[model samples]
Target: MIEKRAAQRHRVFKGGTITFENGGIACIVRNVSEGGAAIDLDAPVTLPQSFTLAIARDNLVRNCRPVWRSDRRVGLAFVQ
Candidate 1:
């Protein structure tokens, strides 16, 4: 297998949420790095181009964009 990630990700199992102006959805942080993260949603849901990912315990609120997605998981890139 080829490693294509720009940065190494750390495994995590923290609960989080994706928030938009309209609403939010529950998700789990599967892995994370400085550049991006992999999240698993409770169910398949359409996400906007940009949104905020909040992990309360970690005190993290990052602006992010979806880079890739499958059934119930999404890969996100941190955006300014």
Candidate 2:
């Protein structure tokens, strides 16, 4: 396999939330970079194309869009 990421991802294990109009879902950030993040969810749920990723402990919130998904994990790209 070849590396295709624009930026290098750093491993992380932080609790966070995925927020949208209706409500929010709890998740764990597995990895992160300036451009995107990998989040681990509790279950397989329908997520919007765009949403907010709030990492309160880090005092950070990023607007994001889903780039990929698996059973309980999602890859997100930060939206400008």
Best candidate (score: lDDT): 2
My TM-score estimates for the predictions, one after another, are 0.95, 0.96
Model 1: per-residue Cα lDDT over 1-80, one tens digit each:
99889899999999999999899998999999999999999888989999999999899999999999989999999998
Give residue 45's lDDT in candidate 1 (0 to 100).
Answer: 90
Local error of candidate 1 at residue 60 (angstroms)? 0.7
Model 2 C-alpha lDDT versus the unseen true structure? 0.96
* Alpha carbon lDDT of each predicted model: 0.95, 0.96
Task: Kindly report which residue stretches of model 1 are placed more than 4 angstroms away from their true locations once superposed.
Answer: none
Q: What is the C-alpha RMSD of each candidate to the true structure, in Å?
A: 0.7, 0.7
